[model samples]
Target chain A: MKSKTIKASATATLINELDKALSDGFKPTLAIIFSSIKQDWKAVCNMLDERNIKVFGATTAGEFIDGDIEEGSIVVMLLDMNTAYFKLEFLETSEKTTFEDAKKLGSIGKKTFSNPAFILATGGIFIDGEHVIDGITEGFGSEVTVFGGMAGDDLIAEKPIVFTNNKSKDNAIVALIIDKDKIDVRGIASCGWEAIGTTKTVTKSEGNIVYTIDDKPALDTLMKYLGVEVKLDETQEIVAFLNSWYYPLQLERENGDTVIRATRFANQKERSLICTGSVAQGSKIKFSLPPDFDAIETVVSECKSIKDNPEQQADALIMFSCVSRHLSFGALMQEEIEQVQNIWNAPMVGFFTYGEYGRSKIGNNEFHNNACCVVALKEKA
Target chain B: MNQNLQTILDFIQQSKHLSEDEKATLTKAAKDADKALTISEFKLVRTEKVKRTTAILLEETIEELEHKRKAIEDSNNALQKSLKELKATQSQLIQSEKMASLGELTAGIAHEIQNPLNFVNNFSEVSKELLEEMQEELEEGNLEDVKEIANDVIQNLEKILHHGQRADGIVKGMLMHSRSNSGEKESVDINNLVDEYLRLAYHGLRSKDKSFNAKLETNYDDSIKTVNVVPQDIGRVVLNLITNAFYAVNEKNLLQETQGDKYEPTVSVATNTMKNNIEISVKDNGNGIPQKALDKIFQPFFTTKPTGQGTGLGLSLSYDIVKAHNGELKVETKEGQGTKFIIKIPII
Candidate 1:
C-alpha cells in the first residue's frame, strides 16, 4: 500500500493536487478528505465525484498533513493498494432513527466486505456518538475492529457536515470499510488527563443529558467544584463549556481504561449537562486534571512502538485528535505530531474532532472526548 | 659530564678545533638551559596540584549544597505539617467559642423566664385551694349558686397549671443545656432529653423568625429508661439537629410561598429502643441537603449557608460530640425533599 497527502486552500487547488499525485503513477482507490468548515464541501464533493473517486470525510476544527497543522485548509489522504479493497457508505439520521440507521450501515458493511475494519465519522451536534458505536458493535460483534471520530466545526459552534462522493449532509454519518485480510491494522486511543477530585456517582441521566450527579443538579455541582461563580444565563453556559474543555469528566470502565467525556452544552432551564458522549446512570466519574508534558511522551512512545517493529513497515497513519488537546497544548500539539512523524516518516493525515472513537487497551471500541486516537495501516507480506 | 668536571676540562682541552671562548660559551649555555628546564618542571607540578585542589573543593561544595537542600526541604515539610495542625486547632477553637456564646445566651434567657414561670405556678396553686373551699361550702348547701362557678374556677386553674408546668420543664431543659458538661456520665432518660431539645430548638428559631412555624411531632419509646451519657453534650447534639431541621423547613416554607406550593412544614423527633442501642431521629420536611455537600457536611468550615448566617461548625461539632460518647450520627437526605439525622448511642 502507498499513500500521499495534499493540502489545498480551494477546490481547484485540491483537484490540481490530486492530478499531481495521479501523474506520479499513484492511482488512489480511496480518498479521505479532512476540510475546514470555511471551505465549500459541496464543490469538493462534486469535483471528486466527477472523477469517479470514492470518498468519505467530514469537516474538521483543524487539519493535519504529515507533521503540519493547518486551520481553514483542506487535507486529502490518497490511498493506493494492490490487494486491499475499499467501500464507502453514507447515512442520514434523525433523533428517532439514529440507532436504526447506524445498524443498517453496520450490516451493510458486514455483508459487503469480509474481515472489514470500519472507519466512521458522524455529525457532532445533538447526537450521542456512544449509541452509534453501540449499534455498530451490535451488528458487527465485538471481534470486529471499529474506530472513528465525531466531526468538528472549527470550535465555532457551527453544524459539522459529513459527506460521501454522492452528497453532503449535516446530520449524517460517512463510513469507510476496508478488508482487513489485505492489510494489517493497529490502533491505540490514549487520554493523558488524570483524575483529580473525588469520585462522584451519576444519579440521574438520560441519553446524553445528565440531570443530576450525586443527587444534585449536575451543572450546579460541577460549577461548585470548579469554583466558578453561579450564573444562570447564556454567558454562564458558555463559561461552563469553556471550563469543560480543560476539566472533562473521566469514567473508568470495567477493564480499567478510562473514557473522557466533555460537556458540549449546558441546559440552564433543566440544570443539566449534555456531553459529547453518552454516560449511563450510576456510573462513577471524576474531574480530570490537565495533562503534563509526559502526556506527549505517551503519544510518541505509542507511535514508536509501532514504527520500531522489525516485521512490518507501516504505510500510513490516520489520527483523530480532540480539539480540546489543541486548546490545552497550544503549540505543544505540533511537537506531539512531529514526534510521531519523526518515528514513522510515513504519509499521515487527520483532523481534530469533537470526540474520538477507537478501540482502547481494554479491547472495546468506545467513544471518548479530549483524547487522541491513532490508526496505523500496513500490508502483511 | 659533571663526573666529572675534570673529564669536561680534559674534553675541552682535547678540542683543538675550537677556541677557548667558544668552549666557555657552550659550557655556560648548557648549564643555564638545564637550570631553566628544572624551573619549568617545578611550575608544571605546582599547577597540577592547584587544579587537583580546586576540583576537590568543587566536589565538596556540591555535596554540601545537596545536603543543605535536603535539610531545607525537610524543614519546609515540617513547617507545612505544623501549619496544617495549627489550622485544625484554630477551627476547633472557633467552634468552642461559638458554643460558649450560645451557652451564655441560653443561661440568660432561662434565668429571665424562670421568675415569671414561678409566679404563674404559685398563683395557680393558691387559686386551686380557694376553689376547693368554695366547693365544700356548696356541698354543705350554704352556697348553691356558687357551686357551678367553683367548678369552673377549678378547671381554669388546672389548665393554667398544666401549661405552666410545660413551660417550667422547658426552662429547666434550657438550664441543663447551657451548663458546662462535667465530663461525668449519668443515667439520663433519652426520650425526655430529645423531647426537651425539640421544644427548645423550635422556640429558639421561633424567637428569630416570627412567621416561621412547623408541626413538631414526637414518638418516644416508653420502654427506653435511663441510659448512661453526658447529658449536656447529648442535649447539644439534639438541639443542633432540631435547630437544623427547623431552619430547613423555614427555608422551604419561604420558597413555597413564592411558588404557590402547598407544603406543611413538619419536624418529627422519634426514639426507638433497640436490643443493644437506642436511636433518636430528627426529621424535617424542608429543602434537603444537596448530595454533593452531604459527605462534607461534617467537615470543619464547610457550609451551604451564606456568610454571617452560619459558622459552619454546628454539624462538625455535633459529630465530634457524638463520637466522643461512643455513638454514631448519620444522615439521610434527598434534594428538595427532606433530611433525617439519626443519633444512635449504645445501651451500655
Candidate 2:
C-alpha cells in the first residue's frame, strides 16, 4: 500500500496537483478529503470521480497537512489500498433517524468484512453522538472498531455537510468500513484539560439543557463562579464564546476516566445552559481550566503509546480535534498538532471538528467533547 | 493460566509418534499461544472492570432521572385532570410550557364549564314548575290565563334547551381549543369565558379549603360578544390571573382574622370593550404586591410567595402568553390597598 498527501485552495490547483501526483503511475484508489466549507467540494468530488477513486469527504472547521495548519483550504490523503478490503457508505440523518441509519451501516459493514473497523463523520446540530456509537455497537453485536468525528461548518454552526461521489447532505453521516484483520487499525482519544473545582451535583436537567446546579440557576452559578457579570436580559446570548469553552464541565465517569461536556449556549429566559452533550441530572460534574502548554506533551505521549508497530511506522494518519481547542489555544494549537504528527513521521490529514469519537484511555469507545482523537492505519505485516 | 500450556508441552515431549522437527515446531507454537493468551486475558480483565463500573454509573443515572421525572409529572398533573379528560385539545404547551400550563388549564376548564350547567339545571326545574301551573290553569277553564300559562311554559322550555346547548358548546369549544391548532385565533365569547373562570377559580379554592370563602363579582360588557383570540391560551392567562386573585384575598382573610380586624375578601373581574382592543382586568381587595417585586413578577422562577407554594412560572408564562397575542400585561398595585392586573389584546 502507498499514500500521498495534497493541499490546495482551488479546484484548478487540486486538479493540477492530482495530475502531477498521478504522473508517476501511483494510481490511488481511495481519496480522503478534509475541506473547508468555503471551498468548492463538489468540483473536487467530480475530479476524484473522474479518476474513479472512492471518496470519503467531510467539511471541516479547519484542515491541515503534515506540519502546516490551513484555514479555509482543502487537504487530501490518497490511498491505494485494495478497494475489495473496504467500502464507503453515506446516509442522511435526523434526530429520529440517526440511530437507525447508523445501525444499518453497522450491519452492512459486518456483512462486507468479517472483521470490520468503522470510521465515521456525521453532520447535524441536534444529533446525540453517543447514540451513533451505541447503534453501531448493537448492530455489530459487539464492539469491534469504531472511530470518527462530527462535521463542522467553520464557526457558522449553520450547516456542516458530508458528501460522497455525487450526493451531499448537511444533516447526514458518511462512513468508511475497513477489514481490520487486513488493515490493522489503532487509535486513542486524549483530553488534557484539568479540573479546577469540587464536584457539584446536577439538580435539574432534561436532555442537554440543564436548569440548575447545586440548587442554583445553572447560568447564574456558572457566571458567579467564573466572575462574569452580564445583565440578565431577554435578548442576551451569552455562551461558550464568553470563556465557558476554557472551563467546560469535567464529567467524572465511574470508569475513573473524566470526559468533558461543553456548554455551548445559554437561555436568558429559562435560566438554563445548553450543553453539546447530555449531562444526566444528579451526575457529578466539575469545572475545567484550559491546559498549559504541557498538555501537548500528554497528547503526543498518548499517541505514541498506541503505536502497535515496533518501529512506530504508519502508512497514513488522521486526526479529529475539537474546534474549541483551536478557538482557545489559538496559534498554540499548531504546536500540539506538530507534536502528534512527529510521533509516526508519516503523511497525515486532519481537521478541527464539532466533537470527537474514539476510544478513551480506558479503551472504552465513547463520544467526547474538547478532545483530540488520533488514528493510525497500517496493513498487516 | 500458563500451567495448561506447560501441561500441553509436557504431553508433546512424552509422545512417541512425533519426529524431532515436529516436536521443536509444536513447542514454539505452544509458547507463542500461551504468551498471546496471557496478554489477551489481562486486557479482558481490564475491559470487564471498566464495563462493571460504567454499568453502576448508568444505573444510578437512570434511576435518579426517572425519580425526578416522575415527581415533576405528578405535581404538574395535580390540576390537569380536565385537560386529559378533554383530550381533543392537544396543545403544543405539552413540551416546555407543560409544567406551567397544566394546573392553570384545569382551573380554566373547571371554571369555564360550570356556568351553562347551572343554568341548564335551573331552567329545567323552572320548566317543570310551569308545567304544573299550566295544568291547573287549564283545569279551571280560564282560557285566557291558560293561554298565558302555555306561552310561559314554552318560553321556559326554550330557555332550558338554549342553556343545555350552551353547556355542550362550552365543552366542545374547550376540546377544540386544546388541539394542536390551538395557536390559531378563533372568535370566542370573552365575557362568557371570563365569567366562567371567575366562578371556577372560586369553587376550586372553596373545595380545597372548606373554611375559605370570598365574594366574587363580574362586570362584563354585554356588547362584546366574541373576540378573536386563541381560546386556550387566553383561558390560561385569565384562569391564572383569577386564581391568583383568590389566593391573595384568601391570604388577607386569614391575616385579618388573626389580627382581630373585620375584613371583606372580594375578588372582582371585569371585561371592557375598547376602541381598538379589549381589556380584561382582575382585582383583589387584599394586600397588594410590593413595589420592589412588581418588576420581577413576570420573571421566571422569581417568586414572592414561599417555596413549595408558588412555582413562580405562572405570571411569567401569563406575560409571555399575552405578548404572543400582541397584547400587553401590566399591573396596578398599592402596598396595602389592593392590586389589579390588566391584559389587553387587539381586536383583530
Q: What is the fnat value (0 to 1) for candidate 2?
A: 0.00
lDDT of 1 by residue, B260-301 (tens): 999999999999987899999999989899878988999976
The C-alpha TM-scores of every prediction are 0.52, 0.51
In Å, residue B274's CA in model 1 sits off its true spot by 38
Candidates' interface RMSDs, in order? 25.5, 14.4
Write one digit per residue (lDDT tens) for candidate 2, span B1-348: 499999999999998999999999999999988867865674465345435434544464466568679988997896488667555443333333444444444554555557767877787788788778878977888789878877887887787788778778766755654454447888999998787666656766675578988888889888888888888778778878988888898888899999999999998899998898899999999899998888899987788778876777778878988999999998999977889999999888
For all candidates, the clash counts are: 0, 4
